[model samples]
Target chain A: MKIIKFTFALLLCATISSCSSDDDTENLTGKLGNIIIKFDNGVDDQDFIFGTSYNTSSGESYKLETLKYLISNIRIKDNNGDTFMYPSEKNVFIIDEADGNNAGEIWVTLNDIAAANYTEITFGIGIDQDRYALGADGQGDFLAKAEEEGMMWSWATGFRFTRLDGTYSSDTVTDEALNIHMGSVGTAVDNYREVTLSLPNMAIVREDKTPELHVKADIAKLFDGTTSVSFDEGYSQVHVDETTTGVIANNAMDMFMVHHVHND
Target chain B: MKKIFLLASALMFWLGCAKSEIQENYVPIPLEVEQPSNFPDIVYNLDNNLVTEAGFELGKRLFYDGKLSANGAIPCAFCHEQAFAFTHHGHTVSHGVNGGIGTRNAQPLQNLAYQSEFMWDGAASHLDFQPIIPLTSELEMGETLTNVIDKLSLDIYYQEQFKKAFEDGEINSENMLKALSQFMLMLVSSNSKYDKYVREEDNVMLTQIELDGFETFQNKCASCHATDLFTDQSYRNNGLSINPKLNDEGRYSIFENPNDKYKFKVPSLRNVEKSFPYMHDGRFATLEAVLNFYDSGLVNNGNVDPTLLRNDNTYGITLNEYEKESIIAFLKTLTDNEFLTDERFSEY
Candidate 1:
């Protein structure tokens, strides 16, 4: 009976040639839609701006000139528990803070998503082991893009998942150079972390609707989340260290929260 | 008999038609990548970039092309000469564009498919991504991946090769790196005298001195050089006194872990004789010097491998003159002459 009802509803929408009717019914089948995942970087509440000082929990201050983080393997789980994954060839994205608009939002628009009533969104913070294992396949021209953005290290074959470069001043250290280039070190020390956030409200996707998920990334949580890392300590330059990077990666997992979704 | 002949002829005709159809459609001719039984399981994922005739050819051309460099002069083969098992012959460390010297020795190019990590410090995680380091390094090719792709796109020959090599047929970094990987996947060199002796092929036997060397090596060096591939594929600080000029922190630079300080990868001793000027920095010119260094010349650079530490609380392996001489003799048996002159991989 449910299947028949769903098909009848879809058929009616197909005849009407409109998926987003003001009525309670939605055409969540046999239609495609586009969704923009807007990444807004902030330090707790304030927008994270370049060269703007942000205080840490440990009486340390850091201002970043460059900030970028990779987001990949984005999958939207619908209300029915069925998940729709963005095609691998186009799913990987590097969210750069400098590329943000005047509103301090970096919009990554994923197109041709299967129409669904999505309730939860899950994504990986860095290049997954599977993607890294693919070698060059599925990676079209993103290597050059990452390299141009200084997200690729010349000495190694891995991508810098998160690149935060600036100065961090502590109680003793005055504006010491702070850089956090955290990424999984090959098949060895894996630092990749995934975060799943239940949407604040149901994101209704249809052929005519362009839903936008406004996701806030709290940059402060990277150093002050589950593990409070100090700038004067070993984490001032969080690199390929297994323990320190893993702690920060876990911290980064808690950074994202979907504030709201606007289906327009 | 007549009926059987008719059936055979009909089957032959069908097979001919199918083969011709493939030819006319320009379907890529697949090439077999041999996995030698003696080596470890292949680490390079072949499913991503399958070896084809056109792809391997394209990869070989790209490997030899100087257009990959900024100045269009230095090629991959410039540093990796075939005669010396792909190392820069007699160079301590390879020299590149504008006499730019590298910090580490150029490693050999054989048996790459079986290895998971690349570089002396395991900097490259995969075989396909390894070329990007040398291609983009300022001390090496000094060319951006995009710039190289752009230059390659101009060549009509490359255009044709790309069309033939990849299905999508775009001269992009993905296809370029995949083609390179396809070519490298075929560079298996598992027919060395030592390998033959182990596999019991062609009734090959190690000489008495070589057998003695094998025994000595097994007793002393086999802890790090564990597998038949001649390496456990691990990073260790083999105590060479620190070369402060380069101040190459080895794997430490990658992870900054204090325990990883001075830790270079325990390189495979597959073709130890031909790939001379050994060690990460190529400090020792001869195998004698290398063995002697292991015997006595090892410095306690703070992180010297505990394996190299003698039970008497001293550093270095205890190798006598006879043991050293035989080990060198056995090492010579690893020189794979066939792989060195293999026409498929050769630029000519």
Candidate 2:
């Protein structure tokens, strides 16, 4: 009789413990969803400024009164280096002169992210070719905002992918009206470039505290091709061209590496 | 008795665990969405869409509500009126917050599923993203999508509607646009006389005068204004002189090819009678003036279509007073009155 009672008590206790364990997991999982990313402009203590101008070799500057671009399709690599791409939404971040101070510090609220330690972060500069053809109906926040922001050219075609406007005076000709237009639509200058970031160490995301990653960007490399062309040359008529786009994309892609991320 | 108690306790524990697990992952099953009757099965149809009636109703409310605007002055209904076949009346350029004027004319909202493009410039291609244009344009609603979503997020009504639409009760831009698209896609128009004529269900009745006008249209306008939707869905040079202020080189703006200058999207004439002052610039106040201009006053330019030039000394579409009147009369038949008065379309 004593042995039977003990067995029954053990069974009841095991079931109760299992139920409580699940409840604890649920509570922890909900708390683990918080993620925070802080962007550090490489110029320490200097206010970050994002602006556009027509590159003129003559040093004539025309400020871009309106500017907007896309940063979409983010992917994060785990400590084991296994990569997981976040489900694509608008995935666009905007920094205006007012709110973000044009320094491009923005926050995103993400949920349901599995709790893990991540080593690297990667993302696309523009929309992928597949989603670009999907049109604007279901494209999350950024692509939809592209139209409202005039970043999209029109319906027959799609977004410019990237818009870099600068006025450049030809070395031979003194005319300042010349500018470079660089973007990707067809194969001529496909602007959709992927940026991969390798962290120095792993960044852990957990329950008691949220993980924060700081990324730094360099602006000088945007004009890497124009050695003879000085910023004083109005601006480099750095328009979207095949060669120029390659240089700019390569420069921007490297900007993500200038950061330190670790567990608190 | 002891064995029975153990069994009952074990069963109860498992059932409780399962219930708690379900509560954690519970996402409401959205209503099954079905294609509307009397419309062609277009590929853009929202299949497997768990669209609910309450969601659609909420979307309709947002569509007409001017409170979404920053100044609370211009609603989507302001530029797109239901009485005018979803096209504004006689306004060359639509007005928005603080009387700001938009660059393009207000386009009619209809049969958009067939279009692979949107806007006079064809910048946007999807129905879901169309609202983004007016919502953020300084000349339109002058509000950001994020700000609008943030405002709606706080509203108890919008929160519930988003839950029904997206199976998650969170008011994000995704669900907001989804709801808006759901409402806009339902604005389908296939009940027009033109539709009836296309189906051969009814005689496309035309007076002799209207018939003469149709013949002239076939010769002069049919090249660009093709059948079915009344557009080739291509850009063309209609020979309008460039306005220095606007500097709109039409397709040249995007293509950067000077040869493509003055080429604008060929607009549909479905509800053209109501959606005027006509032309890309809204230069013509009446259709008669437009006909007169096409008859004798085409600006000869490099990119102008050769077909639009005067041939056989006919001065292009050089229609006399009678021909012009008849052409105008035929154009009126393209109006879909059923679309103009349908309360189902009204954003209540």
For lDDT, the strongest prediction is 1
Chain B TM-score (model 1 vs. true structure)? 0.92
State the lDDT of candidate 2 residue by residue for B1-348, as single tens digits: 679789999999999898656432224444433343544345455653445575667678788877678887678888888877777675556668974766666788877766677777776777678788889988889999888887887776675566655666667777777777767766766666656654666676666776777777777688888855778788888776554335567777775888778888899888778777677756565787678667754656567876676756333557788878887877776788887788877764
Candidate 2 residues lying further than 4 Å off, grouped into runs, are A1-264, B1-45, B48-52, B202-204, B312-316
Per-residue lDDT of candidate 2, residues A178-257 (tens digit): 33333455444567778778777676666654666656543333444233234344334444456655555555565455
Q: Could you tell me how far off, in angstroms, the CA of residue A90 lies in candidate 2 after the best superposition?
A: 55
TM-score against truth, every candidate: 0.54, 0.50
Q: For model 1 chain B, give the 10-residue run with minimal summed lDDT.
A: B19-28
Of the true interface contacts, each candidate retains a share of 0.00, 0.00
